[model samples]
Target: MSKGTRRLAAGLMVSAGLMGGVVVGTQPAAAYPSNCHYGISSLGTVSAWCAGGSGSVRAVAGCEWFGWWTTAYGNWVNVNQGASHVSCPWPYGVRWGGFNARD
Candidate 1:
């Protein structure tokens, strides 16, 4: 290859590497916790953590549930009675008690 072509190629590779690093570093580093972590609330409601926060929501017995939802900003979005036992992505799994529970 010509000297000019070799230098240009090397510069392009370095630029690509730096750009890749910046892109990866700027991405949001969020992940769902390993478990739903069900617990009793102050109101005596049997609930589990929504996806990524500490908020609780009442789970319906005998319904598959995704108790809480993690918002875009990595916060818990609590659910209400009207929201419980609703058709979710994986179907609500026996919400409250641990009866073949799933989400």
Candidate 2:
């Protein structure tokens, strides 16, 4: 065969191999439900729990206002107002009604 023909065939084979590698060599995508984010200038909430409701883990629901943040309860937390919340795995130590926010 001509040199150009051989080179073209080789190039196609390499490309096919590369595509196959991209398809077959990749690991499955992981699911991240908890490690979540809202968006720029948006509101978000997440929860962290302890085994027996005896740990003091502050899981924050955050609100971003252009760049700043605050608690959901309109308390100047740090940046903007947040709509965050909390949850206890065993429902023993954590209390209800606390985090609030304003527009």
Q: Per-residue lDDT of 34-58 in model 1, one digit per residue for the tens?
A: 3454543443334444444323343
Every model's TM-score: 0.30, 0.30
Count backbone overlaps in model 1. Answer: 11
Off by over 4 Å in 2: 31-103
Candidate 1, poorest ten consecutive residues by summed lDDT? 79-88
Q: What is the lDDT of residue 20 in candidate 1?
A: 95
lDDT of 2 by residue, 10-85 (tens): 9999999999999999986533223222222212324432222111223444444444544432222211223234
Q: What lDDT is reached at residue 27 by model 1?
A: 55
